[model samples]
Target: MRASEDAGLRDRRRELLTGARGRVLEIGAGTGLNLPLYPEQGIVELVFTEPEEPMARRLDERAHARSPVPRVVRAPAEDLPFDDDSFDTVVSTLVLCTVGDQDAALREARRVLKDDGRLLFLEHVRADDAAGARRQDRWHRPWRAIGHGCNCNRATVPAIEKAGFRLEHVERGTVPKAPKIVRPLAVGVAVPA
Candidate 1:
């Protein structure tokens, strides 16, 4: 991921995290890649949820090195253990594609976020053009197998709306250093509708 990070993924993380504040919950925070990009202040607490044990272990190690270490929990996005309206912000970066149940995970994100909280996200979504989208469909199975369950063809924007959020801002772009089939991206902020 360092190659991806260096190739503009890190910049996207920085941009997406710029507005994050108060208590924040990050879903599917694999290995804590976004940890270093969070703002230096404003956030009172940071919590990360990762269901995969190996990634969680690495997240724990990386988190403890920070000045105010983030709390890492072993949980899946679909079954967040947080109370309703528990966080002022919820972040999802390159995660929605791989979740076992994308809608359930998003609903859980909406469930935990305060009514006025933001959902800052950067996710690889289905391509905009027909040819590119068809390519994603064609390669999805192989990509999923190689990417370890990541489905690069998800229609993520509509899913966000369906899960009870309204898009406040969105930018359609591409992921650098990623395969063409998985490069289309949606970076945005949404709030509970």
Candidate 2:
């Protein structure tokens, strides 16, 4: 799934990770797709996490393959093992919509983030157009059942704001060649409020 992303989308991912510094934690690190993009200097540590066992093993293998190998943890976003204000940066890409408790996970992300930390995200969101959003609402339940708990209609930007983070910059766009109902995306960075 990661490999199939358009060149532009892959470039967007790199743009989001290239400037990161200090301790970084990547939630839902499936297959460690973003592992190779972390900047070489300044970053103290990079952590990758995934909930499922099989995905965790794959992430482990991928992590070891990177130049600055990341630490892998088998854990869910709603509950992280780290202490509060522990990390300088937190990253989530295409993972929020599927979390069992989206609010809990967002709150957890804020909790572990340092007071001056930033959260970088790239996620599919509920559409702003009424008809499009309605379609997302209608397909959500069944879509989640078959798509690994990924609902195509989450109001991700609002959820990020509601999580008590102030957006530094955010933009919405569609994934090229993907279904429209699942393509409305939000890419941004937010800092703890």
Tens digits of lDDT, candidate 1, 49-119: 99999999999999999979899999999999999999999999999999999999999999999999999
Task: Write one digit per residue (lDDT tens) for candidate 2, span 38-143.
Answer: 7788789998879999989998998888767789998999999999999999999999988988999999999999999999998989999999999999988888
TM-score, every prediction: 0.98, 0.95
Residue-level lDDT for 62 in candidate 2: 84
Model 2 pairs in collision: none
Give the Cα error of residue 41 in candidate 1, in Å. Answer: 0.9
Model 2 bad stretches (over 4 Å) = 2-4
Task: For candidate 1, give the lDDT.
Answer: 0.95
Model 2 vs. true fold: TM: 0.95
